[model samples]
Target: MFLTYKDLSELFPNSRGIRDINLPFHTISSFAEQNQPKGLFIPLSEESGELGKAIENGAIGAIWEEGKEIPKYTPNHFPIFITNDIVKGFKEMTKQYMKKIKTSETKNMDMTKFLFLEEKLLNENFKTYDIAVVEENLSLYIEQLSEERRG
Candidate 1:
């Protein structure tokens, strides 16, 4: 999650593009702020100093661009993922992780069972209804699971 300055430059190539980067969840001030240990993104720029700051702030790991020398200030314990383009690598990694999460969520849920329940709830007019209710229910179920996991 941590993006070094060099990584950002190589991956995004445009400074303006870096500011527009979006992540799945809320981007908090510190990675440790989340309940679970998450990835950190630090643009390895001379000015920001987020890479060093993040390490001091409890970031577990960072993504560094390949062919770029690691900054002398980088700490030893913070693991780094060296890639050709840090931003692209971060996006791809996040996408793959999200897909895995979605896949796992639906793995044990029977589509037929869900359909049957929907039909029963909406009667024969189920075709006119959206799946918002189903999605909400699933979301709640996932939230409960996440809470349980955290506990």
Candidate 2:
């Protein structure tokens, strides 16, 4: 149930892509190096170097700010979503992902028993002890399956 570029397209209609819109991305990662299974890069700066780093590190695609110069290294067929407000667009995409999860999987789950979140969308740096550290770390990795946690 991973989200595809097509799913995000509905959220950002001003996007530009010359490739397949159905490419699946399971995580939303900011740091390029940590993505084991490809991720969607969220451009935090208008610098092409930053975007290029993410791409070179294996970002499947990115949400590019309108008017920002894309890196020359970017392949012509790469998917580049254009948005006037990067923050708003990023928020909308994650929010919709959560909504879809709630209406689908988490709708029937008992919250007390399973504290499931779309951990893929959240890359946390933990500072906890022993089992707590492992627990937190494992939680982040668990949702990259079967469409991930429903919110």
Candidate 3:
């Protein structure tokens, strides 16, 4: 969530009387899914239906297609980014966000090994389990990996 309000403003430079947004947004998401509070909402549809949903779900900012009639009820202060191509606007925003994120590769565990780990932990049966403890599970996982390497 490295995105700042300045970044958003730069992404969609054009707007109607929306100079500064009061609340800062942490994430950008579509209108369909309700993200956490303080999200910048982008609609898949040209229709205004999703705009209302965004508002209800606590979207601090929005992207509106340029030349599309702005809704009368929309507050003057609400930051509505105006872009020629709404779809491309959001897509570009997503692309920028993707670049900022750091992704890690994961090893896919075999089902038998997964079941063995589950069995071992189930005996201890803590109500809240965060994959048990790393120290306790590391040896078991290493043993399994060594077997796989041999096979």
Best by lDDT: 2
Off-target runs (Cα >4 Å) in candidate 3 are 21-23, 32-36, 46-48, 102-151
The predicted structure with the larger lDDT, 1 or 2, is 2
| C-alpha local distance difference test of each model | 0.40, 0.58, 0.53
Task: Highest TM-score: give the candidate number.
Answer: 2
> Per-residue alpha-carbon lDDT of model 1 for 26-117, expressed as tens digits?
12122222221234543422322456555555454556667877767765654555676544464454344344445554444322111122
Give the alpha carbon lDDT tens digit for every residue of 20-116 in model 3.
5334565455442454366666654532246667677676677877887776877777788888876667556544544433241223411101112
Q: Which stretch of 10 consecutive residues in model 1 shows the poorest summed lDDT?
A: 111-120
Model 2 ranges off by over 4 Å: 45-49, 106-151
- Angstrom error at residue 64, model 1: 0.6
**Per model, how many backbone clashes are there?**
11, 0, 0
| True lDDT of residue 133, candidate 1 | 50
Backbone-clash count (model 1): 11
lDDT of 3 at 49: 48
Task: Tell me the TM-score of each prediction against the true structure.
Answer: 0.41, 0.63, 0.56
